[model samples]
Target chain A: MLLLRIASTHVRNRLRQTIVSTLGVALGVGFSVAMASLMEGSQRDFMTTLIEAIPHVEILDEKRNPAEQPATALYDAVAFHGLRPLEDLRGIRNPTEAIASLREWIDGDFAQRLSGQSVLRYSGQDIGMTLVGVVPGRELKVSKIREDMRAGSFEALDATANGLVIGRKAAERLGAELGDTVTLTSANGIAKRFKIVGLFHTGITTSDEGLAYAPLKAVQILLEKPDIINSISVRLADINDATRIAARAERQLGYKAVSWEEANEGLMEAFVVRNAIMYTVVGAILVVAGFGIFNIVSTIVHEKARDIAILKSLGFPETDIQQIFVLEGLVIGVLGAIAGCGLGFGLSSYLATVKFEVTTDIEMTRLPIHFSYVHYVLACLLALFSSGIAGLIPARKAAKLNPVDIIRGAT
Target chain B: MIAAQPQTGTDTSPLLQTRKLTRILPAVVPVTLVQDVDFSVGTSEFVAITGPSGSGKSSLLYLLGLLDRPTSGEVLIEGCGTADLSSAEMASMRLAKIGFVFQFHFLLPEFTALENIMIPMQKLGRLSAHAQLEHATGLLVDLGLEDFLHRRPAQLSGGQRQRVAVARALANSPDLILADEPTGSLDSAATEQVFESLQAIVETQKTTVVAVTHDMDLAGRMQRRVHLVDGRIDYDRVQS
Candidate 1:
């Protein structure tokens, strides 16, 4: 108690020194908090866009490698005695059962779908595309296509027997408009005229120009494989649980279930590197502030040699003297951390309101700032630890001070 | 390097004893500050160490108060040798059994007179805060500083501050009070006041008091005197 009293008195008496040290720590911590918020906010925005734009898990037919097609037999069997006719193979069998199994595994929702590469011819222009056949209601529950729609609706596609929902860029490239009919040709050369009933814009080049959605039954009819689907898209209650649930679903359903994280491993690795850099840069600032604290504390200890001697002469041990100075530094750090938290929150909120479009599919038009209490708490603890260490060096110096030397010099 | 054995629980034994005490300033060329000097003081004794500047009078007092360790031999407090004590142990030993008053008052300027007096008692931690306050208050009151208890050192006169320092020294009620030129910075009138306060404390509390002073008049008032010259005791005598 006496040490604290003494320490507080010294701090109160030396207002300028205390303020300088406190401000040093405050600026460092404040900057760290702001950076933390920015990084966290950006990470959150990226994750949200990722989760919203795609299925958390997709269970595809394990036997089909979408990248390869089954080769056709070169020689056609002649109509001869004892020659058997080749049977036509469909997509994943028992789609309803697979969909039900996936729905049971996923907490939120799931969709059964079929996908095939095709070409759409609009007037004189033709473009390569991957057409996904989705049930409109279930697709809406599983993906953010509904939210990203720039024109028309999924219900329109559902109602129109030969309707297509195409991206804005695809519509532009194909010169297709709502109510206009486009010639869609399946990979097997089966062709049909489908109306462009809706358009969506996700601002992602890959999705915008290469993806088209149509009604499931209509696509099956165009492909001449009715009621057959190749994949199940599942949305989970917790996006983070996708990997584990996907693993379990793959095991139980005998389908290859790919989690979003597994699909975006490269992006996740990049994010990890980015976060490491962000924390390192911000953590350096706090370390610099710690050095400032160390400098000030050292100066104070040098200045207080006489006082230290006097206390020592009064029978105060080295530990007591050390505690006093250490307490002083800790007090400064704690107060600075509190002030920085407030400043950081204010800065983060202000920065969050600054609108700017990132030239990416981040789905945000404002600076993202996730003001997590965890970040604030972590920043404060770091500041405290650093400043405590800073204080300790000088406190040890004060403790090791020779009272006789100081007193002898004073006299 | 033989350590002296400590004698315990004996009345009428000298309260402090220094046997063949020597101190050398360890340096490139070592200089002896005090050499093989033997000294002792009894209970209720008012002794003055008189010497010219650089005669190592303050060094001897520091050695006696356990502020400095002797290069050889031992200084015993209440018949207990302090030769092998750790720094912390020596500090506690000083805190419990010895007090020091420096020439400059050294009354930590940040604290009030009351707070300054409470420092040693608080460090000793034998008394509760309430009791410490009571004892600190009583010490200041005894020093006739009842009115200036809440004032800082800067607000007090030189004499008042030195008296506060004396009060601080007595906070733990030690057996011996060591003052290194306690009245060296004061005017004659303030000097007498400090001297009388210390005198009354010694007579009433029966605590042994050892002081280093250049003032022959003050030294004459002590019951005993040990005069130092060039790091050695030139004379030791009793005043009749």
Candidate 2:
């Protein structure tokens, strides 16, 4: 209570100086909060872009081990795993059969679920139409695959017949669309005709401009490598747990598993570096606010020498005096934190509403500012704690004063 | 020459006693500001110590008031040795039993006259806030400062401020009141009024008063007067 009285007196006596100091602290907190919000928004945007570009996890072939030797390697390995090796692998005597076995497993167990699935057989000309060999209802889970369907409905691949799905960019390049027949030349120099059933446009440059889809069997037949697949993609229930799930999948399926982080390490690293730089800049602002608190509190102590002596003579303990100055600093910190929080949220919301044109080819043209509650709380706490620490020096000095000398005008 | 006659039928207990009190001034060669001072004030007695400037009269008063510790010897207030008391205890003792009135009227400038008087009582921590206020107001009225209770020290005249200081000194009903030239800063008329208030309080409350002063006339008017020279008692006398 006595501390409150002293703090009240301090503020009343030095209202102007206190206000200016508080504003300094508030600006520091405000700047930090704003920077944190911006960093958080940028990271969210980066993650969204990456997730849209690829499946959360991709399964690939494991490397062959040179130490292991077996007779009739491909056929024996595939038969041991209850799978059918592709015809191309059957011709190679003693070839590694693990890849063929993986292809057989996917064709037997997942083929019914692989809707809108595709394959593209390109010649040396760098142009080809999509051979989309999908089940009737399952390929929408792929990244950017469902969102790109612009023309005819997605195609279903029959066991014996071939169909194709091409993107708008490919249509523009080959003068083909739904119901147009296009010839696909494979790497083995085989020419096959496929009817384009759908044409889609995904905004992503890499996918929409070059991608083609067809059934796995049709692509294998066109490429003259029956029962072979290039890669297998998987989407999980929990996107964040993709890394752990991918590891489990690698152990279960005997194939190499890749997570989103491993696939886009460069992008994630850039986000991390950007966040670190932002925190350093904002932390510097908070440090400046701490210095402002120190300056203001010291000045208040210098000005209140006489008042302190009077209180001391009235038998107020040194701890009481220290608490008074500390409370004054606390008042400044709390008020500044509140003001900064309000200002930061208001500014972030206003900025979120303002349309910002981004000329990037891969993302939305206008980016909206994102706010995180955790970051806001952290910023306010940093400001409050820094101000409290700043008060210590002056509070200790105030506590150590000699009442007699002060009252005697020895100050 | 008047003979020294002791009090008649008074209590033998001394309210304040100092034995060979000394205060040293710090320097390359330390100067003995006040040395070998032996003094005691009995209950209900008013004693005055008179000396010229730089004669160490105020130094002796400060030592006796517990505002400063003596370099040598001891101060016993109400039969308790003060040398052994902790700083906090000494402050408490001063708050409970001793009152001080400085020549400069060291009342807080921000507080009103009533608030200044209420300080010592507040420090005692024995009375409730209401009781402390009541006691303070009663003391102010006794000192004839009721009219100026709301006025700050700066707003009041020199005499009124000093009277407020006296009222504050009497607030806790201290056994001893030490005044170091309490009226030194006031005009002649103001000084007379301040002295009248002090004398009236001392008489009515039977509070022992020990005053250090350069005013011989004021010293002569007290019941007992002691003259200090070069930190030693030169003469001691009592008036009829």
Candidate 3:
């Protein structure tokens, strides 16, 4: 109690220096928290876009490396190692069985899909496109295509024969619009004329410019592949269950089922790297604030030499003296942390309110910031720990001061 | 009557004693601050240590107060040798039995007069907070500082601040009070007032006093005087 009282008294006596030290710690915390909020908000935004725009789990046709064959050519042994082409591969062949099995094992929305590369011609403008056929009602449950549709409706595309739902960017490039007929030709010189029933925008340049959707029956007739499907898109109740369900589906259905996590590995890795850099930058700020605390505490010890001697002469042990300064440091740390958290919350909220234009499939008009108490708790702990250590160094110095030396000097 | 005699209470033991006590400041060139000095302070006796500047008068008082360690000799309080005691043990001994008052009136500038007096009691931790306040106020009132009990050192007069220091020294009610020029910074009138206050407390509390001062007149008023010259005792005189 006496040590705490003494420490507080010292802080009160030197108000300016105490405020400076407190602000030093506060600025560090505020910057760290603000940076964390921004980084976390952006990460959340990117992940939400990824998870909603793509299927949580997708079963695709598998291609593999062909078995190598050894041959003798001109007295030298040669090995041929090449990959098998997926064009010759057929569909899963038993689509009903695979779909039934997935439905039985996992609680999710499932849709059959057929995709191939083709070229679209509209008003003399040619664009290479990936043609996908989907059952609109089922596809809506697995992906955000329906939500991103800007004109007409998925039902119109699903009901009308030879109707194509085109990306908005592709329509813009080719001068195509709803109810306009476009020409689509397969690689084998087979062609068909389809009317654009709907246009969708996904905020992705490649997808918007080069993707089109048609009714499943029409695509099947055009490709000359009836009762066949290339893959199934699945959306689970919990996205985190994507990996488990995907592995189960792959093992039972005899196809490669890729989870969103696996599909976005590169993007996830980039986020990890970004977080590492952000934390390091924030941690450096906290450490700098710690140095500020150390400097102020050390100066206090240096200036209070006579007061220290007087206390020491009063039979206050060295340990008590050490505790006094350490307590001082802790006080500054906790106070700074609280203040910084307040500042960070206000700044983040204010940032969230400032509208900014970001390209998104959904209507978005502001920078996203996720408010989390976990960040504040961690920031407080870090600030306290750093400043506590800072206080210890100078506290030890003060404890080791020689009362006789100080008294003699003062006299 | 406070008369000085040679080992008055008991010939076999004195209240505080130092035998061949020597202190050297070790450095590139070692400086001997106090060399081969012998001294004793009996119960209820007031002794003055007087010498020129840098003659180690303060050094000798520091050794007696257990604030510093002797290089070669041993200091014994109540015949218990302090050479083997740990620093913590010596601190306890000082807290329980010895009190120190410096000439600069080294009251903590941030604390009030009563709170400054409460510091020693607080450190000892034997009294409750409420009781500590009562005792601190009582000490200040005894020293004629009741009206200025809540005043900080800066707000007090020179004599009032010195009186607060004396009150602080007596806070633990120790057996002996060590003053390194208690009135050195005071004017003549203030010096007499502080000296008289100290003399009254010693008489009333039966506390032994060992004060270091340069004023010969002040030294003459003590029951005995130990005069040092060049870190050695030049004279030990008693006024009977």
Candidate 4:
């Protein structure tokens, strides 16, 4: 208690230096927290955007391993050429039954889809595009296409027997509009007539110009792959269950499944690297703040040489002397951490309100800041650790001071 | 003074004894500050160590106070050898049984006189906070500085500061008090006040007093004197 008293008295006597050093630590902690919030905020924004535009989990008709002939498997160095097999459709054979079985455990909406390359001919204009077939009512629950529609309703596909929806750009190139009858001829030469029921603008070049949608059963028959669906799109209530659900679904259904995170692997890797760099920068700033503590503590030890000698002569041991200076550093560090957390909250909140729309051409958004207690806890721990070491060096020096040497001249 | 004559206690062992103590600076050129010196003082005996500049009076007192270790030989408190004790143990012994007063008062500039006097007792940790306060207040009253208890060292005059330093020295009620020119920096009036205060402690409290002084007039008043010349004892004799 006496040592604490002595340390606090020393700090109180040097008010200006104490304030300056504490502010140095405060600035370091405050800025690091704000930077962390900003960086984490942007990463979260990108994830939400990616998750919104696609299914949380997509189970495809593709196999994890490619089909190989028996001869190819038997020979390691030699390849077997041209063994043609009978035509058999590659798709989930009983789509409704499989979906019904999966729905017993997983809580989500599921939609069946069939897709293929096709040529659309309307009034003599022809355009090549990918035609995707879907059950209109169920598809809307699993995809964001409902929001992209510029004209006609997704529900109208249920009423109209041969309804189709095409993007705004694709319909323009084919010279077709809502209510126009068009002919879609698949790659295998089977043709069908469908009336355009809806138009959409997705802001994606490929999808807007080269994609069309029709009722699933109609496309299944037109492609000559009756009673088969190539893919199942799932939108779970909790997005975090995507990976586990996708893995279980793939194992059970014997099809390759992909989660949203797996689809954006490269972008997620970039985020990890960004986070590592951010933490390093914040740690370096705290270390620099530690130097400020080291400087002020060293000055106190130098200035209080006589007082140290006097204490030594009063029968205080070297360990007690060491403790006093270290305590001083801790006191300053604690005060600075409290002040820094307050400042960070204020700065981050102010940042969160600023409209950060770079240009009107893109979506308008506010500057993002993720506020969490973890950030404050981490910053304070770093500040305290650094200052504790900072205070120790001078304290050791002060403890080793020879009282006889200092008091000789004064006596 | 105070109706008590100069007499050494008849205990079998001296309160403080030195066996050929020596100290060397051990610098690049190696200065020998205090050569082999044998000394002893009994309980209730007031002894003065007088020498000219650099004659090792202060050096000898520092060795006796355990502020400096002797290069050879040893110091004994209650006839127990201090050579093998750890520095921490020595510090503990000093806190429990010895006190020091310097020429400059050396009171911490931030603490008041009463708080300064309470420091040694607080370090010893043998008394409660309330008891420490009461004892510190009682020491100031005995030294006639009751009005100056709340004043810092800087606020007090030279004599007042030295008396506060004296009260601090007595905080733990040690067996022996060592003063290195306790009145050297004061004027005639303040010097007389501090001298009488030390004399009162020796007479009323029976605490042994050992002082290092350049002022012969003050040295001559003690019951015994040890004269040192070039770190060697020239004489150790009683005033009678």
Candidate 5:
């Protein structure tokens, strides 16, 4: 109740300074929220694009040696049971051992593969291709790999041996197409011919230009690396459980299991750095606004020294007097945070609809703005807290004043 | 030096009592401003402390008013020692029992006359909003400031502002009213008017009044006058 009266008195007495201080804080908060929204939106968009283009998890060698492939223990366990490594198993050991293990394990004395997903690998000349020996029906689980198919059906793998799906850029570079014969030269210098039954284009420039898909057995025979695979890819029931499942797969397979974030560390780091820089810039604006609030409050305390003395002589406690100024700051802070939130939301949404032309070496296009609610809330809280903290110094000084000295002017 | 005996006819406890009230001016040698002064005011008595400039008349009033603690003495209000009270308790006691009027008419410039009067009562936290408003209005009316209740101090004349301050001082109906040269800054006519109002409140409410004044005419009209010379009481007299 005392705070309410103090707040009222503060508003009544320092109207102009209060308004200006609130505006300063609002500007700070608005800038912070808008920048945060843009940063968060950009990050979310980057992650979404990357995730849509690749598997959420990918297995790689744990050795940290680029030359070493992922271990085949889990892959072999799934294959030895006559089960496809990617489809049926939660994880796999050696590619062929997985097939044999699935058959034995299902007879009941041991844990069986979760499902029957296939894994196959093939190498062409010094250029190795990870032949994702996928089941025809469940191939869409691999994401844009299926979406990018420009011709022929994913079912083409079920009907024909030595059939291949070549990327659009790869086909263009190799002068190959649907139903055209392409010779794949293996790592051992063994050459084999395969019919390109499909064409695909992954929108991402790098992958569309390089990746190729083939049936498991055909590639294995062609490369003469039968019952062997470089790695296995498994689709989890809960996509968000990817990290935990990857850890479990690592422990079971004695091989490295990687989440999409690990697979694209460079992109993730770029996103994180971009967010940090944006927040730092926005934070500088808030710091400047906080200083503005501090200055205004200090001046108010100086100007009202006599008035404060009178109130204190009337038996107002130091805490009560301090509360008045603190309340003044809170009023300014709350008003500013609220105003900033409104302005930031409106501005961010407006910007989200605006398409700005951006030019880069790869392509030039207009991109629409984007915003996030979490960033808006964070900015409001930061502004309010900073303004409140800024009020503290002046409030303490005001509280410590000698009422008699202030009233008598040095007597 | 004959010691004065405590009068038994009055209430056993005085409304305000100061023993050896002293104040030291901050200086190289710490000049003694007022010292070894014993003073007491009974309920319903109007006492005046009169002295020349630098005689410590205001310092004496301040000590009795509980606005400032004495350098080496004790102020007892209604038999309770003030030195032992915590800051909060002292404030509460002041709010409940002491009213102060300074020469400058220190009414808050931003608040209306009525709001200024409402301050002490608000501090006491004893009055409801409607009651506080009513009591403030009553005090303003009693002080002949009903018309000026809504006016800010800046909008008022020096006499009017002092009247409002007096009204505010009496708002909580304190047991003792202390005025330090309350009319010192006012013209002669304004001074007379302020004095008349103070006298009227004391006569009707039976409130103890202790005023520090250089105006001998004003001091002579009080029930008792104590003249101070060099921090000690030179003459203490009571008049019929």
Candidate 6:
């Protein structure tokens, strides 16, 4: 109780310095919290877009390693790497059995795909593009492409014969509209005419200008690769369980299964680096505020030398003297943190309401400000930790002061 | 009052005793502040340490109060040797047994007169907060500071501040009050008021007072006077 009284008295004595130091901490915490929200808000926005645009897990007809030779498996041979083997067909052999088995155990939906490059011919203009053959019903469950359609519908692939859904930009380049017949040549020189059933604009320039979707049987017949699927895309109920389920599916199906995190490994690593930079900026801010606390606390210790001597003579221990000054620093830190939380709230709210002068089709117009109480808690903790360290340096100096020397000098 | 007082000496054990108490300031010349001094004060004795400027008078009182460690000697408190005690133990003993008054009022300027007196009692923690409040108020009232209960040191007069210091010194009812020129800066009228306050404490409260002073009249007023010259005892005699 006496310690608190002494601490408050010391802080109240230097009113202007206390306020300045407190304002420094307040600004540090406030900006850090707002910056944290901005950084994390955009991360969440990008992640949501990424998770919706791609499959959570994809099983592809690929090999992680060369198949074990018959001799090596049977005889434990070490130096028989030169053995030649026959090349097998490069696609999942029987997707029906695998898909049925996956459906019995998996919690979400799946989409079968056979994607290949093709050239579109219309008005004597040739535009190269990727054509993905998909089951219209299953593709709708696995992806959000249906929402990007400008005209027609993704389900029309099943409704019309020889139907195709191409990006609106790709169609515009060919002067082809919905219901227009466009001749497409496969990579192997096979050509077929497909009627445009839908048009989509995904806002991404590359996808909008160079992608199209068609019926599975039609593409298989055009590519002359019937009864073969190159990929099975799975969308799980709980996205976080994608990696584990991918591993399980790879083992059970003997296919190379990849999770979304593995597919976007570079983007995930970039997020980590960005987060590190954000926290360092926040910590630097708090450290600067800590220097403010250090300056004011050192001043208080210097000014209270006589009071310290008197307290020592009055039977206060060195620890008590140290505690008084340290508590004075904490008083400023706590008050600043509370005020900073209010400032952070105001700043975040303002950012949330702000809009951009240049608007995009799919990108957000206003600032994405993620509001989480964790940001306030983390900012407050950082302030306290920095202020604690700031207080300790001068508190040690005050504790070491010899009462006799101070009293003698002052008298 | 709780423990058996040490019986290291005669039946009438001196309240404070020093044997060969020397303090030397380590410097280029190794100046000796106090040298090989043997001193003792009996219980409830109002003593004066008289000497010229820089004669180590305040140095001796600091050594007795455990505020400064001696160079190569020991001080005894109630027949118990204090030389071997750690800094923490020394501070604990000083907190419970010794009080101090300096030439400057030395009250924490931030604290009121009542809070200033309550500091020692609060440190000792012998009484509840309520009782400490009552005791502090009583000490101030006895010092005739009843009218300035909440006045800070900056608000009080020089004489009133010194009396508040006296009240603070007597807060823990210590065995001895080590005063270094307590009234050195007070006016003649204020000096008399503090002088009577110290006398009332010594006689009525039975608390021993050992003051370092240059005022010959104040020295003469004390019951015993120990005069020092060049850090050595010149005379020790009772003043009639």
Candidate 2 to truth, TM: 0.77
Model 6 per-residue lDDT tens digits across residues A1-411: 888888888888889999999999999999999999998999999999899999999999887787766777888846665678766778887788889999898999999998889998999999998988999999999999999999999999998768999999899889999999999899999999999999998878889999889999899888878989899999999999999999999999988999999999999999999999999999999999999999999999999998888888877788888888888888889989999999999999999999875435545588888999999999999999998899989998998888999989988
Per-residue CA lDDT of model 4 for A1-411, tens digit only, reads 889999999988999999998998899889888888888888888787678888899999987887665677788699556877545569988999989988998899999999988999988988897888899989999988889899997778888879989988888887788999999999999999999999998778799898889999888988888889899999999999989999999999989899888878898899999999999998999999899999999999999989999998899888988899898888788878888888888889999998866643375779878998888899999999888899999999999998988898676
Q: How would you encode candidate 4's per-residue C-alpha lDDT over B56-139 as one tens digit per residue?
A: 999999999998988887788877778777778888888999999999999999999999999999999889999999999999
Query: Under the 3 Å rule for N, CA and C atoms, how many clashes does model 1 have?
Result: 0
Indicate the worst ten consecutive residues by lDDT in candidate 1 chain A: A64-73
Model 5: TM-score, first chain: 0.74
Candidate 6: residue A314 lDDT (0-100)? 79
Scored by lDDT, model 5 comes in at 0.72
> What is the descending DockQ order?
1, 6, 4, 3, 5, 2
Model 5 C-alpha lDDT per residue in residues A1-411, reported as the tens digit of each score: 755575567666777887888888888888777777776777677677777665665554343332222335536444243433343222333654642433342221111111211221233322334344454544555555666678886668667787777677667665656787766655556666677788887666655665566676666665565555555555444567667766765665566777666778888788778878887888788878888778877887888888677777677777877877777677777888888888887777876776644433243342334666677677877776777778777988998887766756733
Which residue pairs clash in candidate 3?
Answer: none
Q: On residues B61-106, what C-alpha lDDT tens digit does candidate 5 reach at each position?
A: 7677666766777777876677766666776777788888888998
Give per-residue lDDT, candidate 4, residue B146: 95
Show the colliding residue pairs in model 6: none
lDDT tens string, model 3, A122-145?
888789989988888888888888
Off by over 4 Å in 4: A68-88, A118-130, A147-152, A160-212, A221-224, A358-362, B1-11
TM-score of 3: 0.92
DockQ: which candidate is best?
Answer: 1
lDDT for each residue of candidate 6 in B80-120, tens digit (9 for 90 to 100): 88877766788888899998999999998988999889888
Clash pairs of candidate 4? none
TM-score head-to-head 1 vs 4, winner: 1
Arranged by lDDT, best first: 6, 4, 1, 3, 5, 2
Give the candidate number with the greatest TM-score. Answer: 6
TM-score, one value per model: 0.92, 0.77, 0.92, 0.90, 0.82, 0.96
RMSD, every candidate, angstroms: 4.9, 7.7, 5.1, 5.2, 7.5, 2.9
Per-candidate chain B TM: 0.96, 0.92, 0.93, 0.94, 0.93, 0.95
